[model samples]
Target: MSMPGKRVQGGKQARGRAGLCQALLSLLLFTLLLLCVPVRAEPVLTMGYVEFPPFFFTDARGQAQGTIIEMARKVTQRAGYQLNPVYFPPRRMEKSLAEGRIDLWIGLDTFELMAHNTLSSKTVVSTIELRAYHKPGKPPISHLDQLAGSQVGVYFGYSYGGWMKRIQDPASGIEPVFVRIRSQAARMLTSDRIDYLLDYRGPFESQVDSNITGYLEYETLATYNLYFVLSRKRPDTYQLMSQLENAWRQLKREGEI
Candidate 1:
């Protein structure tokens, strides 16, 4: 005959200890669950875009959309980053890019452009052919010699290769009229304000205005190998470039680029 209440008291003490152990084990599991969950940091990149047809532009809803914009989205997503697109005027694009105010830009033909703080990706994203437009019945531009003393309409900040140097020279006799937009250049050509308007093939050929298309004849001038660039003053610049190259190559393989 043991003490009458001793067994009951022992049983209660054991139950209480088990309950405390269970509580501690549950807390440990909760702590482990918290550790297992990843806390993702949002990496952000600012890309500079200009309004040029078939590339990237702001739509009526004030949102950026286009083939180029879509590609940007894909590249950034693949890189585990978020994008903040900043639109710049053609003339201001390179300046912004060079100063690191924008981390990336696309369609750069001249590799040295924005050379100060910019590094181009090792991938060639696109090969673009530049074309010249003149009013119908105007003589074809077979060579640069034909442009002497003729007024050629060009967009501001556009690079026309060696011809640009000649145009800039006062003695070259090639009168270059700079316009802010391609449409303006086309309109100038249609109105005989200029003898020629040069731009990429796709945009010129797809002109929505009949008058501009009906009056223009085209000739291929140059082909440019364009690349995307990363600003040196940005964070994770090389990493972003690597991601961009991989994503771009994958997209190209899938026919999405």
Candidate 2:
């Protein structure tokens, strides 16, 4: 009777020890599983742009490529965010950004954007030199007054450094013709449909055909600084802008941008 009681007590202790060991093993496996799993990435920020080569445009393989696009990617990554570049037509790009359908835009800091309920970065990420291109036979332009009495082909929806008002004034004798795309403006000039084509030098250098460029004469009209524009409609608009601004400053200091 004493031996049976001792054996029963031993079995109960053994079962309790085994249960505790199994639980410990299970917890270890669960912890290892968590460590092996990857953490989710940060949310993506949508970058809006129109085709302005050397600043933002699509390559032949349909990949987004340009100076500002490259900078934006680095800045967003540094800010713990991912970037998703989206293409829009010139007019639509502005509207989408204003309505907050697009989160950010990398372009000129303009007065019109102020009324769009947007905030712009203080960092001057880039600058665009507006240029007037004419046929080689025509005299090179050095001043805005020289464009008087001429039909100038310009990009639609562009401010052109607020020179539009001056160009459109009846007393100025300048007639403005608008093109939806830069390529159209180039074609119009090359085909002699317009007296002059006004565009940016950087874009012309990046996209215009070599043969076409040889036939054109260009003059710098104005230079405008580019900034990151954030739409006010986002709930975290101020916070997002602050993150981007900090990232940009850091990148500048690191000489990475």
Candidate 3:
């Protein structure tokens, strides 16, 4: 009883609806695929350091340049992270590191006494001798007791170790004049204001060129290890430290160190 032309029109309409449903389903499937994919987070790493030559220092251009800086960049890059080196003078850097203002601090000596609990990643370097610089003709103090009566020059708030601390205590016989800057200490030693200036031998030798060497003479007396310190409270500290230690060993094996 239905007309042939009406039947043909109904068939076309049904086909059109079926095509639209298929198109919408295809779009929904595509959207679901996009939602299931993961997005990558940006890689960022913050490093803190003080001005120590041949390890971490400001070059003539005022940019941080040193062997450790280069090594840090290489290691972080391999781990898919970027290095953001922040330079602060020794005291300020220590404060910032304690406050969690920085992620890592390089060239930290093993004996640094921090108020906060800090974790060390690995031994990055070693410095032999807390060397003493004196005038060319002065007798070197080979024994700790020899320095007892002298005014020793040290960087302000710097500590060598428990042994040095005990020796340096005023209650003990030795009295030292602690200076704020390395240059100041050196100048004081040259001018005879202080009997001697104590510093790490490696950096001291590397930084003091021939022009400056004429006024200073050095003697090595103690040794210590340097390491990278991280805030123990950071959740990523342990994992990152492990990764760094592994990377460091690999680099050493590969002669990159």
Candidate 4:
């Protein structure tokens, strides 16, 4: 007769093998289940932008539509991120970006703006031509100094590539008339409320009344490259920025940018 102890040992060995096999099989099934489940993407980002019509603005139907809006959408989508745009006044938008309430800003980048808990993308978002507008009969402005002693209308909160410093200096003698919207600047210029109105020419053409433009003369001040401004307040700030840069590169390569 066979030894009972030996038989029990064999049975233990068999059970041990079965247990291990079952464990491995369960692990395989769990991994397969995980593979079958879709991986979730990062949360939708809040893109903060000012109302620069034809660049970024809410239309008559209350829907945000514009070149910058479209560009932001493409970049975010390509990077596997969904964008939710929120309108903010210029100052509020800057503060929101610093506080991480707004994840991204697509606009002109400046050293002063980048100092506020923000980093700018290497990829150029767009190029904007800053122009100074005055009445047709007025003397043309070839330089900022020419406008000295005259009131120059400028959009509030716009960096204007730090030319704002020169514009605001007492010695420059430029009395700045700050307006909230481009339309206001256009109106002020047309009605002779201000000596000159400074604005980004691209949007000013479409946003301002055509008739008003006919009566005005403009000279290009400078062109600035728009960049993607990312907030430093978020943990994934660098990662998101990298993603955006990569997406921009791919789009550029494909000529889709």
* Candidate with the greatest lDDT versus the true structure: 4
TM-score between candidate 3 and the true structure: 0.73
Error of 2 at 40 (Å): 4.0
The candidate, 2 or 3, that scores higher on lDDT is 2
lDDT of 1 by residue, 1-257 (tens): 68868998999999999999999999999999999999897687788887766777888988887777888888787767787887888658777787788888887636345656788877887767787788788888866667778898876766665367767787877888888766677778878999987778766655447766775788887787768888888877787788889888887788876
Give the Å error, residue 242, model 2: 2.3
Query: Which whole-number lDDT from 0 to 100 does residue 34 have in model 4?
Result: 97
Pairwise TM-score winner, candidates 1 and 4: 4
The lDDT of model 1 is 0.77
Candidate order by lDDT, highest to lowest? 4, 2, 1, 3
RMSD of each: 5.8, 5.8, 7.8, 9.0
lDDT of 3 by residue, 1-257 (tens): 56998999999999999999999999999999999999676487788877777788888887888888988887776666788998987667777777678877765544444545578765555444677789888888665667777788776646664356766677767777877666666777778898877787656667555556666777777766667677665778888777667777777789887
Clashes of 4: 0
**Please, what is the TM-score per model?**
0.78, 0.79, 0.73, 0.79
Q: Which stretches of candidate 4 lie over 4 Å from their true place?
A: 1-42, 111-113
For residues 137-253, write the lDDT of model 2, one tens digit per residue. 887888889998899987777777678777778898888998776666788898889999888888877777878888788888788998888889999988999899999999999
lDDT of each: 0.77, 0.86, 0.73, 0.87
